[model samples]
Each structure stands twice: as C-alpha cells, then as structure tokens.
Target: MHKTNFAALALLSAACLTGMSSAATPAQKGFITGTVVNEQGKPLPGVEIDVDNTLSYDSSLITYTDAKGQYRVDVRKLPFTFQVYAKMKLKYGDSTVNVELVPNNPDAVAGLAGGVRDFVFKPKPVTAEDPYGNLGRVFVERGIGEYDVDTAQVQVTLTPVGTLADGSAGKARTFKLLPSGGGPVIPNVMWGKYQVTATLNGKALQIRQRTDGRTPATWGAAYTGGFTRDYNALTPSMFLEVRVPRAGD
Candidate 1:
C-alpha cells in the first residue's frame, strides 16, 4: 500500500474509533441538502450520496435520495474552515454512471451556513447496448510493470461534440495510477463524439484503439476525434499504455 494511502486510512480509522458521533448535537448544527437527477433532468431516487468533511477529523456521513430524489445530511460541526462534499455512485434506471465527482470544488459543494444548503447533480447515463455508448471505458497500463502506480498522476480529458443533445463537453477526471496503473475506470459518458487527450507526470501517453471487444487492436487514436460506437459492429475501447524507454530491453 502507498504511504499516502496508509495515512488517509489511519486518519479515518482513528476518527471512526474515537470521533464525534455520526451527527453533531444541535449546538454545532450544520446541514446540507440536495437533489439528484439524470441527464434528461428527471428526479433520481434511491441514489446513495456519501458525504465527507475532509477538513474535520471526525468526519464520515452517508445518505441516500428519497422518492423525490432529495437528501439531507447533518454536516453539523461546520468549523469556520469546514469544507464538506457529497458524492454518489450515480445511477439512472438500472445502470451506474462513471462520473466520479471531485469534491471540494467551490461550486460543487454548497457553502452552507448554520442551516441547510441545497445542491443539484445531473449524472450521465450509461448506454444499455453493446459497445455501450452510454459508458466510456479506459484501461491504464504502465510503461513497465515495475513502475510505481502510486507515483504516477494521470489526467484524462473527454470533450464531447458541442451540439450534443445528450450532454455537453468539458468532462474530465483524474486518477492516482492504479496498482499497476490500470484501475480507475471512467464511466457513464453521454453517448457522443469526443476528443480525448491524456498526459503523464514523467512520461508520454499513447492510446491504442480496439473496436468494441471483438476486433484486433489498431495503432491509432491518442486523441479519438469524435469517436462513435456501432452496436452491431464492435465497441471502441482505449488501450492506454505509458511510453517509458526502459533500460533493460
């Protein structure tokens, strides 16, 4: 396990074993409320929202949306410097969307007072078909298996076509390279054309393309310009491997 990972885990464990109760008493009352919906702007019920007050040592809260897609969690100990964020494995219909929201965004979290603050989310939906257009897939492989994933910081950008009715563009996500650098999976991309670009801290990135899951791999598409899916044909999957000129071979 990475040292950074261990530190965070220790913090959570300590807090859980000896922190304030799940909810703060009335005296230190701070609350956050919010609604969740799908791309079509419809209420999404039963979605689980996980809240974390990272700034606070005693932080860990969980809540789910009700029938009306509404949720309220007591962010009680709103220290003058308290920062609270809410996240959920967003789902619509029966599919889980892949939009992993980065909390702490000034606008993503409502800066609540001694009262409740409301927020809204429009989770992208995953396609229900093969070569699923609804979801975008990513596989991150390292330049060499020995390279430490913990040391790699990767940011992937996916820009959708401007006039897309399903959704708009400027959707990006970041990941601390997975075990061998292949763990973070980007999902629930509103079916549309995209311009994909990626970069690494100490190396360059090259993305190989494979149609759906059946065809052979091709040597193209570092920036998949307006990638489209054909359900009847094959699906498009990205094979992102790091370019590190190793010493051994």
Candidate 2:
C-alpha cells in the first residue's frame, strides 16, 4: 500500500512538472455546422465565424460562411463551451454577431457530426408609443472598440425586427451617443423589447452586453465586440449597458 501510494504521488508530481492539465475529456468530440441569416431571412454569405472553447485544445476555431451562409468547423470536444463571433460586410456596413451556445448532451445528441444551430442577425429599432408603463432603460456605458476618444457620437438606431427588415418601416428611432458611453435613453414607447444598434462613423460598432451564460458573462468578454445577436435586447424596466469592445482590444 505504501509503495502504491508513493508511485501515484510521483506520477502526479511528474505530470505537474510537465505542465500537463487534467482537463476533463468530454464524452464526445466532433464538428459543428450551422447557417447565418439576416432578419429578412437572407443568408449572410462570407460571414466569419469564430468559436472558442477550452478542452486542452490549442485555440478557437476560425471559419467562414459559404455562399449560402453556411459553415462547418471540425472540433475536438463535445458538450464543450462555445463562444461564437460572426461578422459580415454588408451594404450598410459590417454586421457583427455574438452567440452563447448551450448544446444538448452529446450522449443523447443525434444527426450530423457536431449538430446544427442557426442564427438570425437583426437589430431591433425602437418603436413609438405613449410615455408610460413598465418602461425599462438602456445605458451605453462607454465605447471601447477601436474608436478614438474623439469619437463624437455613435449612431443609435432602434427598429422592430421585421418591420425594417422587409423595407416596410413606420416605426424607427435613432439616437446619437458619445464615445464615453451615453444613454439612459427612455423610449416614448411602452414597456417592451427593443433592438439596439451602435455605429461609429457609419460603421457598425461592436458593443458588449451581459447574457445569462458561463462564457465570461462579464470577464470572458474582453475586446472582441461584446455584441451577440440575442444579448443586445433592451427589456422593459431594465437598464442595459451598451459597451463597445475594450479600447485596447
């Protein structure tokens, strides 16, 4: 018994000295595939997708969408953490997407090597209504990204998801913001959900938002435009911080 214990300790010590991590191996490892589209149901071709995970792997998976806005990446971990970042150059400007994925258990997952998850990238425009009710507030803490301190004001536009997507717009509002993060903008509309868009110099500005996830819900997000598709919603009676990527980021 004494000899066995000593040998086990020696092995552990050697592993530590070798800088070996006992990162838990997921029950499975495979590739993941999915599609990206605009709110109008149009595929966002050429969109770059970046997936970050930690499973003793080298780094994140950097991939891009095909002509049909589809992408597939070969990975080595299942039920692993997925922090996704997507960006596509559009006529208006560059559209960025961020997503937090909580995939189903690999032990029970079916179809395809990595499963499928589709996304619709659309920023909501603020609608107009009587000033009253359970109205929530959204705050833009500060502009981070690559913007200079002199960034006078970012163009803030709020529109309903589909209303503006189909070129049919009667409910759209725009606001001007400072690089130092300006907001507390109260909508004249009733308490409800609103989409957020922050742009610097007519170009899409990647901002950060807090989401209910494990991937740096706060800290995990550094400079990489904290803007995820679903994370940028403004809820009634809530004040959300619209942050650009970290300055140095």
Candidate 3:
C-alpha cells in the first residue's frame, strides 16, 4: 500500500511539471502603435501607413491610421528595423524605426507596432519670383530671321548651373518656349544669371547666351534693332538675370 501511494505521487508531480512548462512558453504575438501629425501639429486622420521588415524583402505590412491619427500592427516576429510611411492628400512622409522583441518585455519590443510617430512635413513653395529679389519678364528672340511661323515649334530647357555631376557645360536650366502669334517670351523670370538657348523644330539654332538681372534695354541699341521685329538676326549669345524672391523669408 505504501508503494502504491508513492507511485501515485510521482505521477502527479510529473503532470504538474508538464503543466508549468506549457504555461511558461512565450506567445507568438507582438504589436506596435504610434501617432502621425502634420507640420502644423495637427493629427492627420485616414492616412495610409506601410510597414516593411528590413531583413525580409517579401515580408511587408500595410495599415491606416484611425480618427485620432493612431495606428497599430501585429507582427509574428521582430525585425531589426522597420520602415514606416504615411500618405495624406498628395504628400508622402516616411521614417525608419527600430524594433525590439523578447519574451520578458514583449510590449516594449512591439511598441507602436505600425504607426508613424510624430510625423511632420512641410512642402517647399514654388513662386514666380527668382531666388534673388529681381522681378521682370524674360525676352527671347529668334536668332533665325523670317521663318514660316505656322510650321515652327520652339523649345527651351532650363538647368541650374554647377548642379550637374557630369561636367556638362551650357544652360544651368532649360525651358521650352511656346510659339505665340507675335513671338515667344517667358514672363516674370526670377533674378539670377541664366544661360539661354533657342531651338526651332528640334534643331539647335544658336549657342547659349548669359542673361543678367538687367532688362532687355540694358543691351542698348543693338537689342532694339536686332530683336524688335526681326527674328533672323537674333543672336543667342546673351546671358540674362531676372528678379526673384529671397529664400526662407
């Protein structure tokens, strides 16, 4: 009878140990949460959020923020880094946040599961003024005289000087000039030195000219007679600068 009691106790103890082991196993779930805001400190609702694990290209997740601009995501495993992005209206904002996962601190590891935290974005405004404060119209004259106006199309391309990495010389910028009944003129040019080239019907007509901030009249009588009504004598060798607004004001 004593042997029988001892065997029963041993069996009960083994069952209890098996139950404890099962209870101590870690759960397979982790979560994240955060908020998104605009540059004006306003919570942005209905913004789209995308989460991607850096370690796995195929493993990605997507979600949206709630009315309070908050988001949440549940992930099975933790990645070293997760990329988060938000989109509202026509703008897109993105950032990378690190994630930590462990059994003891699962909440800490999965903090802010799939939301953009404190997002702020400001778009740069483009105006008619130049980077400088000078303001005026850009006058372009045809270097080639008296072509059939009905059959001709003019194009101009603008590029910033010293911005090209390939050491290309010529206009820092180029803009295509639309053909008007009288001629082509780019109005309200910002103030900066620019290299200008005029093209007709896909053919390069002249070399680039530098234009300063001064008006067309600054070229004196030579511009008056050559550029007035005559399109052929237009020499494309001048540089021009127009007025533009100051930066960060």
> Could you give candidate 3's per-residue lDDT for residues 1-249 as a string of tens digits?
011122343355345434433322224345555556543456667767666666678676778778876677776456445665555443111212111101111112332333223333322121223211112234455333334322225544443333221122434334443233334444323323344444556554443222332533332111111111123322111232221112341
Best by TM-score: 1
Q: Residue 6: error of model 3 in Å?
A: 84
Name the TM-score of candidate 1: 0.36
Predicted structure 3: clash tally:
37
Model 1 bad stretches (over 4 Å)? 1-29, 75-82, 90-98, 101-112, 115-188, 191-237, 240-249
Error of 3 at 160 (Å): 24
Please, what is the whole-model Cα lDDT of each candidate in the order they appear?
A: 0.44, 0.43, 0.38
Evaluated at residue 89, the lDDT of candidate 3 is 41
- Order of candidates by TM-score, top first? 1, 2, 3
Candidate 3 at residue 138, lDDT? 42
Model 1 has a clash total of 5
